[model samples]
Target chain A: MALSAFILIEVAGDHTKSAFKTIQRISGVKAVYTVSGSYDLIVQVETENLQTLSDLLLSKIRAVDGVTKTNTCLVLNV
Target chain B: MALSAFILIEVAGDHTKSAFKTIQRISGVKAVYTVSGSYDLIVQVETENLQTLSDLLLSKIRAVDGVTKTNTCLVLNV
Candidate 1:
């Protein structure tokens, strides 16, 4: 089964397309999209387990060049 | 001065209207709105400090009926 998570990220620069591309390449990431108002980007990621999800975010998503901050919400159910 | 926070809340029932009213009544809550996809409700709260904001959510907002889960996003700037 895949664990779903919604990641709300803040980027320092206007590299929306690049950020989306980078997040797509990360393991376990399912989808990414731009949101209006408050948050810059919303990413949907799926993983086999929570630990793997966290690891992928720490090592990959957070390490992306323009990403300034990230807040993750683990989806408990549909 | 004020600190802004975006709160993502999950409701067990279809009580979107009631949730918005209850959250708006909270001391530090600035605005509340419904968003599409993933999370059910998004609330914007402004407080004098982070601790006050946390307190408001824990004491008042979270205690409201119908709210199943809540995740807070603190806005650092803009």
Candidate 2:
């Protein structure tokens, strides 16, 4: 089963372009999109399980130079 | 002094209309806006402190009928 997640990321400054490039390179990321307000970026990712998803985020996405903080929401389903 | 927080909310289904109404009614909400992809909604709120913001989210916003999950990001100075 694929576990889907949405990640809300806060960047250091007006680094949307750089941050977007970094996030797109991360594995397990299904899609990345920009939003109008508040958070700088929103990303959709799919993984086998929650643990792997957590690991990927911690080790990869969060480690990007421009990203300051991240919040993850697991898609429960409709 | 005030603390600014960005809230990422996931709804049970496609209840954007109802959810927006419920969120706007909550106190301390600065602005709420819809995003283009991934997460359903993004809200900007200002509070006296972190605890008050947390309380508002838990006791009020999160308690709304259609809300499924929320993740908050405290804004740090740029």
Please, what are the lDDT tens digits per residue for candidate 2 over residues B1-78?
688777887777778768887898789998665544456777778999878987988998888888898877666542
Docking class of 2: incorrect
Pairs clashing within candidate 1 = none
lDDT of each: 0.75, 0.77
Per-residue accuracy of model 1 over A38-68 as CA lDDT, tens digit each: 5777676888886888788898899987899
TM-score of chain B of each: 0.86, 0.89
**Each predicted model: what fraction of the native A–B Cα contacts (within 8 Å) does it retain?**
0.00, 0.00
Give a tens-digit lDDT track for model 1, residues B1-78: 577767888877778778777777787777676654567776767889868987888988889888888877665431
Looking at candidate 2, what is the lDDT of residue A26? Answer: 86
Per-candidate clashes, comma-separated? 0, 0
Off by over 4 Å in 2: A1-78
* Each prediction's TM-score versus the true structure: 0.52, 0.53
